[model samples]
Target: MVLLHQLDFSYMFVAIILKQMTPEKVITITRFSVALSFCWPLPMTSSRNQIFGYKVAQMFSIVNVNLLLLPCFYAIYLRSDDIEIVAKCISQSICQIQSIAQTVTCFCKHDTLQRIVDELWTCIREAERYEKEIFRIYIARCGRFYGAYVAVAYTMTILYLWGPLFLPIMHVVYAEYPFDVNRTSMTAVVRAHQIIVSHQCCAHLCVCVFGAFLIWFTAARFECLGVEIQRCTDIRMLAVCIEKQLRLRRYAQDVISCFRFMILFVIMTCSLVMTLCAILIITKTSLLVEFMFLLVAFFFLLYLYMYAWPADHMKDMSLSVSRSVYELKWYDETVRMQKDLLNVLVCQSPLKLSINFLVPELSLRYYCTYVSNALSMCTALRAILDKTVA
Candidate 1:
């Protein structure tokens, strides 16, 4: 009973701390991400001194991910004969791969990202009062989602980081080292290293948050464009709307180009992780490990969902620009205005979020298909596992 009380107290304390730390007043997602830049060496700044520091931090982050990968690979090799251990190690490896992919992509696309940030900030500044309100609403919505995501992610990290303290035989990561982790000194060293890498992983995951918010921000602009088009009272207003639409299309394309590769890698890896976890859940004997895999599988699905939801919405909103124009009282307008409206409709199509020739359009529909395929794969694996076991 006393132990239970202590656990409850710990939970309450963490909840309090997290609430206090949450960025409740952040009016712009870009601003919030700039704060993350200080921690993770993201290309959110142009200052020479800061760029030097960011390069150093970026190098350290890459080295840290590599170090984590070494032990994970070695552990997989040492435990190759054990299917369960191998499965666990592979899952960890996938996570590091995700971190490394995002890290390297960010590093390579530094100048491009800076331009995107600059353009996004300019959009924010040029927003009208109503448009600014739209942005604020979406920013708050995203902030709440991000706060919950971080809370859950960090809570899980803390549990795994300190798992060895509670479970005598469990280590933070299921990897083997040349030096015995059973030794107090070695254990401390390994735990410290794991703890640092785990936080670095958290930082990498924030890249997802940034991407998600950008999608939302773009969608919000499309919505604003829809409003502006619907309120067009003259051909002059319509011309301005047409020009804005062109600029927005180019901006959305830039946003998609910047992150498409990372998205592709995430989708592929997350799909594999989900399939493996599903199969492992059915075959694993340890209830704790099975539950862990179940959580992991669910998180991976959510990870895909985070992108799919915004991508789908943004596409819809962008395509709706034509509809918004159609709904305008254009029948009473001059012939020239009518011809221009037709031109707009002819040029407008859904701003698709996809990797050309790599995957289908990323949307809610795509997410459902991905989930369905994963389930199918899991079922086939289950049948094979059953046959092999029998």
Candidate 2:
């Protein structure tokens, strides 16, 4: 009971966040996100459908991470003079955009996405059967922490946009590039443009948030599976729970494995994101704004570990289930009971929940490797960019 309450209280903040980050809610948000990104992060159009269309948005998400996409976008953002400096900045942004779009691909297929989310919900429901309060605590805590992390990161990003509105100094957000608004003196028109930008930014952030939530949900599922183990009674009925646990485990794996593309995308673009951050920070003009950007980059790494840590824990728990077999009163049980015990003991092998167990166990060691690799790549890319600048 004490453990129950501790788990319950620990997830207090998480509960608040989960209420808002449901799968249904995410789908609705994705619609706005799709609309905004294609229309250049603008919500509604000056005339509508001028730039935003079904083909345009669909084509962009599908091909945004293509090899040539980054270079093409960099070219578009280019100016006549200071090509070298602008080129570096554009390269960094390209890395960030491409990395993000890779995750977006996971949501492109509604049917696949629906199945994945259903599996997630099913795991949660199954876990609830054993310990309702404990599951609630873990899910809520996971939800809350991720929710808070995104909120802080988005606030910093938005402030970077809205800072000049409040500050005494009237520096344009990107004065160096100097984009001028070609608008008539219409207040409603200007407000509409602002709304578009706001929606576009929100959608971009939502993609990242959704990715984070997916990992958090997996962790919560593992918590449920682990908790069930401790509460597991060695009885004739134990066989039934074992079947349910296996089914739940498979479902969790299916959900995670479905997003293999997202993971691969992150891996491919991670080096660039790290490189971009490192280069910018070293040559950052504004300390405060760049720091916030750094925080945003850091959260990507945080999200990676959130997925890995629970997977590692789940691996330990699954293996530990077999150890329980050693302590059972197998001698006193009848033939059927002993047989069932034997079956479970054999089934509960050391399970490493990863992408087919090919990836390293999602633990601190793995996370350190991820960080180090990204940093190393960043070093190389920064060196190349530095020589280009010189």
Candidate 3:
């Protein structure tokens, strides 16, 4: 009865929190992101206690990731001869490491992140009805995509955690701990920890969604700027438009700068994981395991494409800002206004998001190239394996 009351209280507490978080009928991506990032150290709190709490959560998150990661490393060392098991452990470890990297990046750069969010919110508040409507449309679309991603990720986590119960496995995750998991108490504790860590891992993956949403936000702003340019009828309006265009350009660069390393890391890790998944699919005989690998590969590709598509759209929308200047009636304006417009055109270059200035611009073309390269690598790996077997 005591345990039942505690459970009821927990449920009620969760309900109250959710109620407070979503007072509005419609929940925007920003609000949903806030909820998803409850454990993340986003610079949202003002009180010292809240800041300390976030730090504590951040510490716990890092510890959880390492706890899972160390066990996977140990499992890899223990089962070096089993290719299938090693592949699974490596895949899981890579994900946890990625989570850790993302957490560290967010924690280190929360100030810049907060500034970007403030800029976005300022634009939203200052925007006209049409501009707000434009943002709303993009926000709605992103909210749906983010919602779907969280659903799929959490569903996979649930399946992964519960699979051992209905299968031949002894533990939830394929990890080796120093202690004996054969013992009931130890096993239960380890399994619960694994489940909690897996959920945390899923939450960390929402960083990808947050990044994509920022890109979409930039694109929508560019589209709004285009509209603003079209309405320019005088030097003052044109000046305002030009100022906004420059601001948007700076904003886009800031977004790229903040996420550049993350993009590079993701591309590198996803490429390797895709290749690993391909190898596993070829070597693993179990249909279930093969399907899981296939899903992982597909989702990674999809995540990459998510960034690529928006980045490409943002580039096009950015260029269209300068083009919108052409639609303005500059012929009737004075020579000085015409000269200023010409200068604006000359300065308007295409904005592209690259990975730390190393990779090419992120676009559908880049995404396609990555997919093709991943496939080629998979083919090469398969050939080598076949040759060895022969």
Q: Estimate each model's TM-score.
A: 0.85, 0.63, 0.85
Q: 1-390, model 3: which lDDT tens digit per residue?
A: 533454455455444444333212222543454343342234444577876677667767888789989999999999999776876787788778877777777666666776787786667667788887787666555555555565556555666677777767665678998977788898778888888777777776667777777888899899988998888878899888888788888888988877777778778888777776767776765676566667667867887777888899899999988889877888988999899889988888889998655687999898898889889999989989989878
List model 2 lDDT by residue over 190-304, tens digit each. 4344334443444454454454455545545545455454454556456656765677567556645655555555555555556657776656446654564565467557656
Q: Distance from true position, residue 315, model 3, in Å?
A: 1.0
As a whole number from 0 to 100, the lDDT of residue 212 in candidate 1 is 76
**Deviation in Å, model 3, residue 147 alpha carbon:** 3.0
Query: Backbone collision count in every prediction?
Result: 0, 4, 0
Positional deviation of 83 in candidate 3, in angstroms?
A: 2.8
lDDT of 1 by residue, 117-147 (tens): 6777677777788897777666555555665
Candidate 2 all-Cα RMSD: 9.2
Q: Rate the local accuracy (lDDT) of all candidates.
A: 0.74, 0.52, 0.74
TM-score of 1: 0.85
Q: RMSD per prediction, one decimal? A: 4.0, 9.2, 6.2
